[model samples]
Target: MTLPTPLTGVVPPVCTPLTPDNEVDVGSLTRLVDHLVTAGVDALFVLGSSSEAAYLPDRHRRTVVDTVTGHVAGQLPVLAGAIDMTTLRVRDHVVAVTAAGADAVVTTAPFYTRTHPAEIATHFREVAAASPVPLFAYDLPVSVHTKLGADLLLDLAAEGVLAGVKDSSGDEGTFRRVLLGTRARADITDFSVLTGAELTVDSALAMGADGVVPGLGNVDPEGYVRLYRYCRSGDWARARAEQERLCGLFAMTAVGDPSRMGGSSSALGAFKAALHLRGVIDCPATAVPQVPLSSGEVERVGKYLAAAGLL
Candidate 1:
């Protein structure tokens, strides 16, 4: 199937399913994918930050792409996360994602150690040149210490090295700058900017962003789909109300302690927990060491869900 740029709408970073034995639960994953698609999401991004790609082995990651691709059957755009920090690893992932029939690939800047803007530009240049599929720069500075400047982004877009970026820096100013930079280029219309932070969806759209990649979309897929539609339709009032609803759900997960409980530390765990609540997936299992929600946290999540009418 031909895949178009999902310039607007919600693309959920789906949670990775796990077996009781702790393996990738392929069956559960397919069901979850089907559920999200049925709920009206514009696209599906696999092995993303919310999908916990860093925990899985390369083989497992490739399996996830294959599984989701087959389940989706080209109904919507399918984006695979390129999670490698090493050049060789990133290239290998690109090869695998293309071979698995992914519609596009989303990649984060190298993390753990920060690299210069020149190096960042070079890294994406190499990937974009070698990749068989379009590359979306994953710009979540919180996850990756290195940030992509709008000038660097413009250079990449000019060179056709980047299809777009997912701006999760939580910096609306930077997002606006990048959006304006990309929008100014006639050749860069193909370049899209997605808001990775749920709280910034409305602001990003108002700033001329293309779309959003919200973790909450994994659980409340319908809410996000509705929210995006409302925004695009110029119904700010309804969109604002929906955004508030999602923010309420996000607060519980965002407020948890991350040191002792790594799962609670991430939106991924909260995403899975919400899925478990909705019965979309069998278990809300995050990899070990990332502890599950505490009783208090779970109760708080329940209240948030009830208030949001998701429970």
Candidate 2:
């Protein structure tokens, strides 16, 4: 059950494929895992933000973990999100996902309730103390509404309260600060710094990030794998080219008219639609309450795919 201390390479926060009736689409999911496995992704992340973790019930969340971990069969390490509004709830999720076969747990600070840094620190320490597997802090201010400062992260890393960070805060300065902070510490040799910014993998890698958890990687894992390899080999030109192509493909996320749906719907819908068009999944349906893409939006996604040479 051991993962590389500083887990590296492309790890897409996998998208949850749903049936029209809003159930987890098992067949599509296993096939998606098979697709990522074939593409040579370093690991699998099943129930993160990209996986619609916010929308799933406890039973469905467990089903997702069981399905992905069971199908993966130990081919790659699996990390599941243990997100909630408080310490006890997150600890319960940590217990559930790990018991269901998650190799590690990624969690965020308490949300939906105002909290202090002291409370947040206590929350992480208590949660980590209760977990069997390694715990990673997830710094996604957009959803959690609390940005994890570099000082706090480094302090946590120093104390061994966190295995790594999955950062989606879009703050490049803090990203570099975390990377620099970790390298400066002789004892913090294995703390990973993974960026969730899909558009900037090349920049992130060049600046010494450990890896990426790009949501767009779900639609194109091989592209990210190639990009990561290019960066590792110091092939800046090729990496830039690959990243530019992916950036263009990412425009599909904006096809869902802003007036009609939120950015989350646009992005997740585009990923699923692209996956369906790529023949990697069946029924590009997202969960309920998130507006689905329109016929026009789906066609726009197909055009982006065609342009990206994915269709």
Candidate 3:
């Protein structure tokens, strides 16, 4: 299916389910896909940050894209992340995922090397030129170490090099500027600006963001869908209430002991644990090298789930 001109509504960044040995568990992956699709998300984003794309090998990434897109079967757009350290590598992923049946590809700026804005612009243009499908810029400064400037994004939008942007920078001021700038630019039609801020869906939608890619939505897809519907229908009160509830659920990410694990371990571990508790997937095992959540942390995830009425 063709992507929506301006992709809108809730699009959850799906978490990858791993086997005991760390292979992509296709059975669990499909089950998770059904969970999100049945919950009424607008799209499915696989191999994203939430999916542990950075940790997975190239073969596993292909398996994920192929599995999800084939399972989705055109019900909704399947956007795969072509995350890498530079242009050529990203291009290779873009080709692989698209060949594996992804509708579009998302990527971040080149990283691991200091890059100028001009270089960033050129990198995007080069990648876009080679991409077989629509390309979305993933502005995740925390991961890429490069914040995508509004002017650069707008300039690219004007040039039709970028079909959309998934802004995960968490900078409200810059996010608002992108929204307003896109709205004000007559030449930049069909440029989607999706927010990755899980806790601020209401405010971002209020400020005119096209949609959301909430990682927490992996655990509570229905909540994010409800939040999106509430915002789109102009029910600010209901939206705020739902957002606050999700904010509470999001606290589960912090349940892991900081002394024992890194942020990815805590956050991603919590998500997989929630999914396991909810019986959507079999094993809650995260990719290797990331510490597993303790039984205590898993119980805490259960508490969050129970409180959210998900259990």
Best of the candidates, lDDT: 3
Q: lDDT values of the candidates? A: 0.80, 0.93, 0.94
The order of the candidates by TM-score, greatest first, is: 3, 2, 1
Give the Å error, residue 132, model 2. 0.6
Q: Give lDDT tens digits, candidate 1, residues 157-240.
A: 878888888887887777888888876778665778889988768767877888888888877888888888888999999989
Least accurate stretch of 10 residues (summed lDDT) in model 2?
183-192
Cα-based lDDT at residue 221, candidate 3: 97
Residue 289 displacement (Å), model 2: 0.5
TM-score of each: 0.94, 0.99, 0.99
Tens-digit lDDT string for candidate 3 (152-243): 99999999999999999999999989989998999999999999999999999999999999999999999999999999999999999999
Off by over 4 Å in 1: 255-259, 263-266
lDDT of 3: 0.94
User: Judged by TM-score relative to the true structure, which candidate is superior, 1 or 2?
Assistant: 2
| lDDT order of candidates, top first | 3, 2, 1
Count the clashes in each prediction. Answer: 0, 0, 0
User: lDDT tens digits, residues 143-260, model 2?
Assistant: 9999999999999999999999999999999999999999898778689999999899999999999899999999999999999999999999999999999999999999988898
